[model samples]
Target: MASAPLNEVCLAALTLSIVFLTILWYKLTSNISHKEESRLPPGPRGLPIVGFLTFLRPNLHHQLTELSQHYGPIYKLWLGSKLCVVLNSPSLAKEVVRDQDSVFANRDPPIAGLVATYGGIDIGFSPYGSYWRDMRKLFVREMLSNRNLEASYSLRRHEVRKTIRNVHTKIGNLINIFELACVTKMNVVMSTMFDSNFVEKHRIDGAEFRELVVKFLQVMGKPNISDFFPMLARFDLQGIQKEMEAVLKSVDSILDPAINERMKMLSEGEIWGKGKKDFLQILLELMEQKDIEISVDLVKIKAILVDIMIGGTDTTITTIEWVMTELLNNPEIMGKVQRELKDVVGMNNIVEESHIPNLHYLDAVLKETLRLHPALPLLLPKRPSQSAVVGGYTIPKGTKVFLNVYAIHRDPQVWESPLEFQPERFLNSTNLDYAGNNMKYLPFGSGRRVCAGLPLAEKILMLILASLLHSYDWKLPEGENVDLSEEFGLVIKKSKSLFAIPTPRLPNFELYQ
Candidate 1:
């Protein structure tokens, strides 16, 4: 009887093992079939688990371009288990940014953006719901309206003049144009946002606020492995979150006092009519309204400051630096732009908003520079809140959608000699404008969430470039040609900091003497 029982137990164990194996096989096959049936846009097959994570180089734009050539315009790649669909062609980009605008309006929940802006309460990372709409409306009405533009014009003009003066002082010496551009842009942004020229104050720490701004941007822009693979995200593999949190704390520490003082002034009604009604004042006034009960928190204030600093300063500086780099590389185009500025602005006076419309060639050079090197080349990653079809492929809900503005801008089919630095291409096209209507050149992006500071940014860029060219001639550093190589981040900065020697030019001088 004991031997018989033992044989029965052995048989039952074998049967159970077989059943487990069969179930596992069925599940594995079903998963494979479902994955296959999804029919995601074609891409290079990546390894299991990691999924193209290893193939991504530091220069994301080049990598994406190479992949686009192989996998057509619209392609899908797996960033770990998450599906990232990259839209490469202009037509496809238009469909996502325009035709299906609302569908892809949401932002991906990257840890960096979350930490930097306190969980997407800021305008940039905020979702496409009521909060986003209200914040955007406030941003446009308070920060970027025509009255604000007029009030801020003198500040911008003064900043540009100071930039020219600084560059002229460093004439004939190799200067870091990147730093110059960054400082100039920050000064302008600060003056507009805070009603104070903090850059002008000589602090012992040497522009502590500006340095903090740079640190914040660097930390926010740095790539985090956690953002890609959630499994590793739990480990904080790259320590990106820690770094972001530290930087956020530092930034908050710096801005808290200023915010509190401003709040006090607003409560006492002493801030409104005292200054020219800067961005912070406007936001405070709006917050006082019964309809808009904007919370008075360090996070909300810091978030707004982040928007102003990152959105206003970084893009402006990058655009100016790139335009100057291109001009230094191709002196002839630079000469043309200078000539236009001289003729339009008369060189004795500063370039005003009125002069911008007349300087067509200068506009073209700016447009082309933007085309060749968009400030935010990838143009802020967006995700789908719901399932949708793009280019006949089903993009499932919660899929990260990257509108590859860099790739689309460089598409050979859409642009003639896409790789070349040709500003004249824009001069001939009427369809190209920066108002988000033009799908071809989206330097400031398009759709409902297009950059709120577009008008202000354009004015600043035009005025700053015009003033610089109007006052000085730019040349590359000694023994080095202008480097066109690019570096990747939230913003696409030049690989090498743009180093140039500015030579003060005679008013209206067209040629370097």
Candidate 2:
């Protein structure tokens, strides 16, 4: 009986080995034939089962740049089952974003994003189709048009002044610059999102909103194993999905009541003649319209609101932090900016929207800051709607494509002294505007999915930087140096919080108040 059992065990072991070998052989042949037929981009052949997933590190942008050097500009990597293609050169970036834009407009959003964006129905992650186009049109033409943004200037001005006042009280103490900017951005975005009367009557907690944004960004930036291996997505081993759901719930708790109140007010004609209706009021008005093809439901309204709040706050703050960081590190640049501000708006006067056009150097400083440290370094990942050829390599349908704007901005072939932080590079260059026509310096990306918030983002960023710099002189804490090191996530921020002391710079003390 023992001999018979041993023979059966041996036979089972042999059968398993044969099956494994047969499967391996079939996969090898199929991949070989596919490669010959597909002409796939060159890339590293990672380990058999896991691929390059385990080799990925923090600061993914830097890692991808390094890979570009070894594998040429356009390359592919098997990140588990997903095939990701990274485009490092401007030409290739243009090919995906401009040449074949429609084919590559859809987003392969992470699981966390889908949850946060109400199943990816928002402008950020919605698939490329009529729905996406309609939402984008609503956002660009109606919500963030110059008319609306101009009307909302007072809201921005008020929040920025409040931040200046708060900073004035904390003079001579170490202040966290990122935190300061974060609060100011959050308040400005909230004020602009809803009318003052609504915010005041609804008693929406700004602090709670800030906390929610922080948590949401944190979870969104985390690398979930589920994203790499879709088979594990249902498991959500990292709890990212759960965290995102909780954030959405919190977001809805605040937004739902406010939206309902706004709707109720609109029903009774309470919002008419309310000093230029705010974004929330405008969206509510659109929601009730029966003539439009795309019905603006409550979820769509809330999702767009979330997009403005989260997208507006984080990118604005991150860019401001980088601008301040770059200025602090390069004192001469900082001095030049201050001198320009003083000349443009006189030391006695405050920064106004009209003054922005004349502050050319300050504008260049912002451009250079974005060049060196774009908020979304790699930009949001895109997916092709169908099989397409990019850089002469076949990008199969549904491959994750990353236009490495970080690398393109720093390419020596394109930029002179690519690594330097010289704002002068952009001083008189009208060709390098943020409109995405110039593919080499796409800090805000290009093509159909370029940042729709560009108009509002630019206004707030310029206002914040001008206000802070013109009002206060910033210095690093005693015995400390400005660290330009970065921490990469959904957005790239300084690896460490920038702590600085501020002294009122203007001759007029009352300006701060």
Candidate 3:
């Protein structure tokens, strides 16, 4: 008696119900059979085949945080066929990163990242073993060492001062804050790495380089069909792999010339590392000094350079933008930062690198900003090399582990009014340090595979935020309000770029120039 469409709908519903019930039954039996050996972590029983894919939210971090409330601190989700474990508490995070660090040091680099990172040879997401250790040491010792960073301070200072002068030129005009931050950070990075400055270089447009970086970042963050389903990876169903490769081509074009020039300089014995050591010179010297125990090849050098360039720029740019957004949204907090800067550096003077440490309130503001909006909210997905037990449950080998530090930072048990923006919490905190010693507050991640550029990242971010606040008063354009909404991707960025008007507060025009 029913129409044909109605009959088809009824049949489909019945089929789906049977499939769902059958999957649940299978899981129950499988668990019972393996119960004596190992207990699997508890999680939602999703639909057959696709698993929990249908329930995925646009903001994956929030969804994972919400799931934590129901599944407890440690829970699993079947994301399109891949088994994912989400750790929502500091203790659980400590167990994985600290208590049993080596076991989980392996990385399952996403499909897009694999192409972007040139097949996972880079330090950050490389597999756990000798190669990763070698690269990390080379980066920390040769490039990012305190001595090297100190030597490069003048380069960094030059870039920041140049940015201030440019900002001074357009004193009350509406400008994109993220663009400004990107160019400044790019200038510093280029100057330090290749003895080049974006502001001074007219041949290469700053906007072009900025666009390439943003595009590459978006690709790295995009949810590729291949990452969720390994079987689909070879097909390149969504073209994400191809797209990432293209972005890499553009980036490599920029980096290739620098690498070649350094190579030629080293071969010609031109006294490359005699003074003002750039990262390229350090790597070249290591490569030439065959007596050195560590490994340094041209391939490794380029890989590390790409890693530094991508990692350094995005994190600082996003942090500056977010800190400014939060401060603008809360004028009282903005006033507090200005007062601290005034007391430390004086109202007539602009902030400098040395004055940064003296401004404790500014430190609190930076820490608070990091806590609220971590650049990598999920913090570079880590993988287990072998089966491991966590929180009394068996975690199967190769399960992608998402250490939800963002969730942990917002845990009501750990922070008071966790959702509210409060920098005072960090004003005198003894336990919390960005060094990853405190499991609850690892802005740069914790353990062996942590971010290699932490020292520079901290210095650059703090100085940028402090200098900007000390120099100007900012306001949104007419009818435009600050939007604190965030977009989750490879890096968490504001849904919109922060565009505001800047007014110079300095008494002297000489300082601006």
Candidate 4:
């Protein structure tokens, strides 16, 4: 009787344990399924805690491209605690960035922007508001207006000549044209912004400024742990804020001296009396005008300089480098462009700004290059100012949105054989510019915050590209193939440095002198 009672007690304990486990498993699975069905876009399920982070590779574009194949155009992925919705088609991108532009016009204040701009006070990161409107208007009217363009024309022409001379001197030697392009572009912007030039004998802090700008761009482009986790944002989890602050300090050190010098000149009536016209001079004039306070912190001044440095240098150079690389890799296309340049500008003359308009084939090549490798493969992240529905999904207010320009550009549905580098496609099409009206090409972005420097950048790039093509026939160094692989940061850069050998064309030989 005692043995039977003991066996019954053991049996009861085993049965209860099994029943409890079954209930717990059911509840956990049920909760997960419910969460999954709550209307999030299709995506690969990720592992616990770390999410899909481990799956991400160094070449983020490739990783995203592959994921889009399996997950459709609009897909979701978790980076740590944050949910990222990537728009993969041109139409979808237009929906988010164009059709609903106002709803998504606000910028997501990245850690770098916050620190660099002193908490989103700068034009680039300032949320969509009255202040941003005011600053943007100032940028447009004073800095990039036609008057400013005319003022800077002489400096641009001089820089173009300097670049040609540099290339002419390097005729038989292997040269990294990308580096040359960067230096030349920087000099042009510097000359216009400050009355200084990057002469061989007069090194006016160009190296220091270049170093600081590069550092700032790299740090700002890094993936921040704080960005993905809202809880850790305030803590600056990955030390991004610290890194940014250090860069900002370096930038301010260089900028403040220039600003102070200009201020002193203004107080002394040196600028007004001389009747000089420079970017700084123009801005000072605006600052003094009635109805404009010009904020004591000099936010407008710093912001304009930052915009020039950020907007002016890397992007234009990168575009030129990519175009040159593509042309070199595909000689047929290059030959066509060269022929066009020769026909339009003629071999006897240098390609001046006046010549750019007539170089249709060269313009097409530039558009094609931008289509393939937009500087910001994913343009700056935009945040929703208010809750809205996009493609049937509710986007909560403050949700970060990104238009994947890379994916959109590469989509086969939009362009036949999208991977091919055929500039002819652009020649055949009526729509070829970066204005928001055209969804197919948005290298300069679109809508309210479209790049302020678009006109200047386009003019400079076209002139430089046409001039180089008109002046020289270029070849890749050695037997190496020109690599089209890309790396992304604040801007996308070639994975390998593009080195080439340039031989001056006989027709444009006189221009080199």
Candidate closest to the true structure, highest lDDT: 2
Candidate 1 vs. true structure, TM-score: 0.87
Candidate of highest TM-score: 2
How accurate locally is residue 26 in candidate 4, as Cα lDDT from 0 to 100? 45
Q: How many backbone collisions does model 4 have?
A: 1
Report the CA-based lDDT of candidate 2 relative to the real structure. Answer: 0.86
For candidate 3, the 10 contiguous residues with the lowest summed lDDT are 28-37
Tens-digit lDDT track for model 3 on 49-92? 66798988888888899999998999888776678889999999
> Against the true structure, what is every candidate's RMSD?
7.4, 4.3, 4.4, 8.1
> What are the lDDT figures for the candidates, one per model?
0.77, 0.86, 0.82, 0.77
TM-score to native of every candidate shown = 0.87, 0.92, 0.90, 0.88
Clash counts for the predictions, in order: 0, 0, 1, 1
Off by over 4 Å in 2: 1-38
lDDT of 3 at 1: 56
Candidate 1 to native Cα RMSD, angstroms: 7.4
Residue by residue across 1-513, what tens digits does model 4's lDDT show?
899989999999978955664553344334323443476577778755445877888877768878889888777776655556777777777787778988888888677778877777777888887888888887777677887777777778777788898889888898887888888888777766766532332345877777777888788788887776555577786888998998988888877777777788778876431333567667766777777634424766777778777765788988899999999989999999889877877777777888777888888889989989988887887877776666666555665677778887888888889999988888877766867567877887888888877888888998788878888899877778879888866778998889999898955456797
* Alpha-carbon deviation at 363 in model 4, angstroms: 0.9
The runs of at least 3 residues in candidate 3 whose Cα sits more than 4 Å from the true structure, single-residue gaps closed, are 1-38, 197-205, 269-274, 478-480
For model 1, what is the alpha-carbon lDDT of residue 46? 75
